[model samples]
Target: MAIIIAGWIDLDVEDVTDIIASAKAHIDGAYTENGCIHYIWTKDVFVPGRIHVYEEWSETADLQYHFDNHWYKDMGGHLRQFPRKGSQIRKFRVDLIEPVYDPSGTPRADFFTAK
Candidate 1:
């Protein structure tokens, strides 16, 4: 099963733009980890001082390894440099994977390959 993490972080800085610029190293470093499908952090379109979090891992073991990596450990200190507010991040264990478009070339919301 795949693990998906999605949510937002409220930064205490004046603007999220500066923080994202400083996060380049951490973001880039995550891509080097094994079983890392995607890792990203960006500012929300309508929110100031808010950063949206999104990540995908192959499995629990992969994510566990990431936790022990230096990149992961350093990110905490980087973020704590500023006075942060509340954060809401959630993790989901996905049981099925499928394309958003079906064979007929039509987009659908329901799962077509779940059986």
Candidate 2:
């Protein structure tokens, strides 16, 4: 099972390009780290200044390594320069991973939670 971390980060800045550029080094470094499955930061096309972050690690130890890395600290410092409007991040322990699109060409909603 892999550990999944995903979230949204809303910045006060009007443009997210500079922020992304500043963190590029750290992002790249993260990809080279051990047990890193995926680490991505993407801008919201519909909402400027909004950035989405997603990460997956093979184990908790790997995620802990990321938390203690100097690059991670540096990235945090760079991001602090831009005031944040709001942010939300969550970690999940995934037991099973599946694609939303099935082999039969049907979209599956098996993971939906009823309200």
Give the best candidate by lDDT. Answer: 1
What is the lDDT for 77 in model 1? Answer: 81
Which pairs of residues collide in candidate 2? none
Most accurate candidate by TM-score? 1
Residue 45 deviation, candidate 1, in Å?
Answer: 1.8
Deviating ranges (above 4 Å) for candidate 1: none
TM-score of each: 0.93, 0.87
Model 2 is weakest, by summed lDDT over 10 consecutive residues, at: 106-115
Q: What is residue 16's positional error in candidate 2, in angstroms?
A: 0.4
RMSD of each: 1.1, 3.6
Candidate 2's C-alpha lDDT? 0.87
Q: Per-residue lDDT of 7-105 in model 1, one digit per residue for the tens?
A: 999977658888888978998898899989999898987887889999999999999999999989888888998888889999999998888899999
